[model samples]
Target: MSAVHEVAPVVDAAHAEPYATRDEYAGAIGRIRSAAEAYYAGADLVMDDAAYDALLARVAATESAQPGWAASDSPTTTVAAGIAGGDVEHSTPMLSLDNVFDGDELASWAARLERVLGRPANGYTVEPKIDGMAVAARYVDGRLSQVATRGDGRAGEDVTVNARLVAGLPAELARPVTVEVRGEVFMTDADFERANELRTGHGGTAFANPRSAAAGTLRAQDRAYDAPLSFFAYAVHDLPGGEGLFHSAAMAAIADLGVATTAGPMAAITEPGVTATTTPTAATTDPEATTTSSPPAGMPLCATIDDVLAAIESLGAARGSLGFDIDGAVVKADDPADRDRAGFSSRAPRWAVAYKFPADTRTSRLVGIEVQVGRTGVITPVAVLEPVQVGGVVVTSATLHNFDDLVRRDVRVGDAVFVRRAGDVIPEITGALLDARPDGATAFMPPQVCPRCGGEIDRSQKRWRCVRGRACGAEESLAYFAARDSMDIEGLGDKVIAGLVRAGLVTDPADLYDLDAESLAQLERLGRTSAAKLVATIQGSKTQPLSRVLTGLGVRMTGRSMSRRLARHFGTMPALQAATVDDLQRVDGVGPERAATIAAELAELAPVIAKLTARGLTMSEPELPTRPAAPGSAEALEAPRLPLQREDGSPMTVVVTGSVPGLSRTEGNEAVERLGGKSSGSVSKRTDLVVVGDGAGSKATKAEELGIPCMPAEEFATLLAQLTAVRLG
Candidate 1:
């Protein structure tokens, strides 16, 4: 809602015509209902507001023309069907509001309400339409009793714990009263920035928008993370008596009870038969309707549509400065009795309507389409656009998401397109303006090779990845390969890895083995002495255990623990490479799907493994404890026997707990691996032995419970010494 200025209606050509058949109306209603359900569930909207409004308008017009033909559960007649998973039933249904986009639609809605009331409807209150999750908090006596989300409008999940964590939400009321207060849970801009920062710091995916962030945070079962959320009570219902208070009075009472309400006072729209052309200056408008820099102390009264329009314009102009995001302005009947008399539709109140602002969009020319390779080797197309300002941000490029999205939008290199930012970090092209398409524009074809590495592309999946694997994601892969848990190559930090990739000195992990002091010194900031040390570090990493090497490979579904299990099970790179899908599935953590993926990946790494081995890297497990030969047996002459083996002469599954006298947990695990035994972090029935060290905890107790043999730290040390003696004998 803005100043009452006469402007032509911006009609959508596609939906300008009225529905011609009952089937068309039915189809439109069904689509709208599905979209509303998804939107309420915090999922991506199936259709944008504009398109949805057009369809809704069509359905409404159809219903008006032929009331008998309207479906019983049509979107126009019913609230969104609540999503599943709610555990708490609501006392009453939470309804949706009808939306009007411009002055013409607003006038039409106002005129309809007047006809229903049999008089010029007066006393309207306007407030910001917060874009957030709707919630209801029930207070018994003075203490907060329960909180629930607006699930399907009828019921919602109990979120009392999470709700109490939200800032500005009061746990107790000022006076003892039993009531249910409805409000919005939202994240401010600063809150969104900090939340995303924390998420990215912990390597979690960042939320796309504030509304989504609020919804996810509110619905989380664990209230551990310091998630920032704020709430504003909009409406309150007193239980038992069930009497509704006036809109302005209810908001005031909620605020008095220590709950924050929407910013700005309720501006009354009381003009009778006011058309879009009606205009009034400050002199002609009510003195009470004069605007203020900040929200007034209480609700302001507007005597004419001109005053209402001015107030809306003022709010719209101040939107960017507001702490929370508002999608539109809401107009409600000021008098509670008037609202009740107007009655309710199945889904919405007939006495109120929301006037949505136009979407923040800008038309810009698509200069070109550039495909960028992600760390996972997914090739995403970016639209290079002529610089355009959208939502106060200068957007030069927009994401196409993927090739499929690119084709679905049918955006072309030389076509004019509309860009929208919304809450996404990156702007996106809403759609191509086909009317402004330049001649000779053609559909974009995905590249046959990776744009960065010129490697073969795998198009079998929804997102195309490089057949060269991590080699195509060079720098990131190199960093992971050199990480402490992997190759443990000291001094190979992000800056060093970035310089190496940029200088084209490295492409694959094997290239690290080829670097000498002279080659390393050529990198900026690496002195001769530093280069020598780096070279030595790279040389030393070649002998890091097989598990470390596997972890460095960056295989999908394989991490430190899984890598260790695989190395222990296979015993050698050649053995693991030769593993069939069925063979891989036998390993502890590998499922059928994961087994197939590992098998296929290992096949691809065959050549890379051969190269690393050729470069002097370790390719097989070290010798394990050999079985003692019976009197004068050939095995006794072949190899020295060690004492760490089980009675059956198989390697023991040893669980080491607490502090060893001189060895760290990692060192102890490494020693076990070196002795041809599997080191486990937990004790189980499968464990052959448990090594108990000082301050031994639950693992030691569990070992005793399971009747697994226990060895003290001194005994384990003596056993290692005996193994060493046999190896040297």
Candidate 2:
């Protein structure tokens, strides 16, 4: 047996806190256990991966420093924090891996392994530590029988039904031999997109990340639709007539038997002629690649620990383009003999270690806490942070989600906090860096009344709301309505709107139409001439398109594109108001929740709509270009090709960035829709085109990076004119 040795107490830079007291240690342990439970149960995580890891490290350091202070039920002593439960017994313990954050820690781990073996290790194999759920699939006589999660190592929950549907995990193997395949179930980038589409289509909230999506989908028995899942085998066990085979050979053998392995095929090198190559060819072993009839490829076989480190570094460099998420690289002793000699720890195998990449997270100081009221009157606390770069973006502020979340996290002003871009996109403060907090830092108090109107608070839900609802934020609503992108009402700014609201002349958007030049002239700074011009602008706004009217109304879920869609689909305001939840769902991206929210908001604003209608506003959207006749029909052959549409007649998704000549951002987007293309707000891989203009920033950069076709604003303007002429003709 390998001698039991304590890991050296080396704190990662991210985990500098030593948990100086028992209370501190216990507090950390409690948080870690809670996070582990939420993670394994496929629920929304209260803490991010980085924060949890930091806390775990802090707990371990404290336990090491004060030996007898460790509790029996501490997360340090448990596999998966002892939260994940199951009834199915694994053939062998499904062990977790100890983590090493940097090359020094990794090298130290390697040295320990060498000491246990009483020699330099034979070789190492590095594979992506896919950020996914771990499972073991038992194949009886070459046919897949059952699958179970890696719950608490020794036993796991059976999920046979869901496992059968996963890609890369074939129901029947090429050879009908009894063996257990251990692998990860995860969602690829495409799979994640498809999953979100399906989920949102069915009225469910979209998942935050692919790992969580895979986990939830894998364990769910009552889902109305299946989200896609993928599997990659990392180890095989209990194969007939295959004892003492090198770990590399076993992996290749499994691949030959039609199981997917991320490390690809690794040729067993019994001789000294094998050399490692730096370039990545291991991606050819991806299960998606197998569909193109590519031959099975091999991953690098590292002859030494140095080579293993190089392979890990190469993998890290290639991470962003992999089309999948990997939190780290798993490096293992390649020889079965070496693994046998190293044996097992109570919670993990000594043969392997996970080299964790630093999380895309950073630390920033919380300068202040402020609350903002949304259109729905929900009061959310936002953190004003000292500018920090996280995931390639400078974040100055982050939403605390709600007051309850703020209290739960216990973050305070003057505290150095852990900041990460949640989903690699949104800036979020997970928790405070207590070790860096100032002596006088204190908890922030939630506003008992609405910050905007000083109205009574509705504290029934975690997200507190104001009793006055939309009326509480009337000035904000009016400002948006008169903004250049919406109604285009000139001379009406925030100060004017606030003065009008204070004078009780405007309580909702509908009240704005009731003001004449005489009433408007009574406001604080307005003169007769200015009020007359403002009134003329407000009256002229009545002639704006129905899409603009929808934008000005500030519907909960309807943005520019959505408003256009609703206006086009329903044609008139009356039709939209008459739409049922099911009818509203017919609009693109309008799922059940969004549809319900839209319907309820409309119903609440029925009086406002009546007032606007009485004021003779334009209520009907213009018709779209007439669709050509059915394909292969007589009219179809004679049909003129629609401008801005693909040959297949589908509308192109176009994004407009920066300023276009003589056009506001909203007008530019509207022009795209009017020209037979759909306008998107952001640039993504799927974006077909981008209209670039002066001062275009990240969106323009992203379009160029993605290789999406781009047109200059001048060219776009010319094209828009031509399209408009064609449509008119």
lDDT of 2 by residue, 429-470 (tens): 655655446898888988978998889999986668899887
Runs off by more than 4 Å, candidate 1 = 1-16, 19-30, 62-69, 81-87, 239-245, 263-299, 361-729
Number of colliding residue pairs in model 2: 0
lDDT of 2 at 22: 87
Per-candidate count of clashing residue pairs (backbone under 3 Å): 1, 0
lDDT of each: 0.68, 0.74
Predicted candidate 1 versus true structure: per-residue lDDT over 547-590, tens digit per residue: 88988887765767677767777878989998888999877656
**Least accurate stretch of 10 residues (summed lDDT) in model 1?**
279-288
Instruction: At residue 630, give the lDDT of candidate 1.
Output: 46
Q: Which stretches of candidate 2 lie over 4 Å from their true place?
A: 1-138, 141-359, 363-369, 384-387, 403-418, 423-426, 431-448, 459-462, 627-641, 657-659, 681-685, 694-708, 726-729
Q: Please give the range of 10 consecutive residues that has the lowest summed lDDT in model 2.
A: 285-294
lDDT of 2: 0.74
